[model samples]
Target: MELALSVLQLAVRILALPVYVLHFLGLWSWICKKWFPHFLSRFTVMYNEQMAGRKRELFSNLQEFAGPSGKLSLLEVGCGTGANFKFYPSGCTVTCVDPNPNFEKFLFKSIAESRHLQFERFVVAAGEDMHQVADGSVDVVVCTLVLCSVESPEQILREVLRVLRPGGAFYFMEHVAADRSTWNYFWQQVLDPVWYLVFDGCNLTRKSWKVLEQAGFSKLKLQHIQAPLSWALVRPHIYGHAVK
Candidate 1:
């Protein structure tokens, strides 16, 4: 009976794939571009609640590079909903970039709420191509939960390196590929295509940390972590800094 049910489910997903593809090509892009960041901004509150301790540590790392003096310039790639706004020190300038232009409104709201961290500008650009930003101009580059969905992780990292000044920091927190023996890993591999179709190209099994290490960062610090068991498929994560 279970085998039959599994087969039925797979057949349904297979049938849905074309529909998803069409939606992505049609109105889905508009919807995602318009409201996805708002959804993420609210979702982040609950997400932070679930991983409060980890978030604290991540923000601490951000502060070390940004510092209290706030003279630093930060360029945040995939700055969805500006969740990191409050964590930044006062006097620092922040430039937010996201492919989803709808995030601009939410980012403005976040900036208003934040006591520190001045808004520099909002750029509508993908992580793979950030030509609007000048090379070696930013003191810190931030990426959180971003690489898994980009068309080319390597290209995005190259862009990160190009934008950051020498000895500048790249702060990141990302969900990544899981251990092969785990049930979550098995399902992640099996469902990746459908998952991407539903979630705007988010991949469940990317080895993001390894990609960052190979990107020629002069210094790297990384630690693996597991999310709450409730979100099993995306449980594995890595968060740290890489200096260019």
Candidate 2:
């Protein structure tokens, strides 16, 4: 009887979280874009350099995925606090975007000052809005740990494809729910409620590669790994590059 009740409770646990997750997601979408900037500036470095550092090495074989790096015209959507800036090769001209109000003044200040591109804010193309950029002008579009927070993952990827030139590449790193692990499934199911609220709009189970494939990034070079600290439970991470 206790085991049956526990199973029933787990079932309820799974069904109940999304309601709150969706509700909190709405609240965070507004708060995250406006939350503390200078403070976040300092904090972003910790996450930027730490967790993102590990994820970056997964793309070490860049030549296989993104081609050569010189004279490249790249766009980074949801370029949170410019963590990915130093990772990009020198010759590449990057146009980066993030909607955070903090992003403009404090987060992307360095990006706005880059000599490589004539324009300011790099790309500043928010996921919720991508009409600002011209079609077929971009050589690479990157999303590192960003897609999990996008307002509409499907529409944002559509815009990514729209702007990228034929043969242009999409490089990405993200976390998703783990398959084959009951513990991971259980915690991802539990913490996801508070998770989406506190940590921006990031989802614990959004398989970004599948989302990319469905959005027509048909030529894909992909990798999947685990985050050292993804959730308190399952840290499933996905890393890959797809060509448009």
Candidate 3:
């Protein structure tokens, strides 16, 4: 049985070789960086409209984290197009981090539109390694729809912990793997490889909630719900906050 499983995995890898080649040539990254931010900007309109109430509730008390300047320092990892800017409290000093430099223009547009927020800077870096952000320098860290595509969720969470001040808050929302018995889970398992290739490394079967639960947060308030997205495969979502 083990040998059969190994053989199956090998076959899958062989089938995905073209994708690996494109990645090696940097063609896949280039294509995604050029187009994905534009796509996300369109998608964010629908997503934000649907998630407004929940986001408002989640971010309502950010004033609690405000410093002497009457503003809270916020770090947003994987901040594609700055979709969360409108949801943040006024006077937030936000530092945006994303691996793709191409998103900088769209991020600037969002920042321009969100006049209430104070733009700190935008860093081109991945979530796993944000050495650019100092230790315990941020009061809040926001991540949404990011873990599914990241190379390492655990490492990203570690960086989140490292960048947050004592008693800081980490807000997260992510689509997770479906229930084992459901047909959605079966399809997610079957389509994950192709999905990863097509959607810029997003895995449909990532159990991101499990990673967050074990991420050494001093306090965690997690809630699971079916997001009102058109895609059924990504409807199972977990959202909440964790305190450092």
The top-ranked prediction according to TM-score is 3
Please, what are the lDDT tens digits per residue for candidate 2 over residues 1-244? Answer: 4475467556755765764565557754555556645545776576565576665575454434344444667788887676666666555666767776567666447565554443334445677577888897788887877788777888988888898888888888777767745667655655565566656666776766777778888688776766666234536777778888
Candidate 1 residue lDDT tens string, 120-155 = 899999999999999999989989889999999999
Please give the lDDT score at residue 85 for candidate 3.
94
What RMSD, rounded to one decimal, does every model reach?
A: 3.1, 4.9, 3.1
**TM-score, cand. 2:** 0.75
TM-score against native, each model: 0.88, 0.75, 0.90
lDDT tens digits, residues 1-244, model 3? 4475456556776888887788889898788778788889898899898878888888887788776677799999999999899888888899999999989999999999999989999999999999999999999999999999999999999999999999999999899999988877766776677678768789899999899989999999999998888888998999999999
**lDDT, model 3, position 186:** 69
Tell me the lDDT of candidate 2.
0.68
* Superposed model 1: Cα runs more than 4 Å off: 1-9, 15-18, 63-70
Clashing pairs in 3: none
Between prediction 1 and prediction 3, the one with superior TM-score is 3
How many angstroms is residue 133 displaced in model 3 relative to the true structure, after the best TM-score fit? 0.9
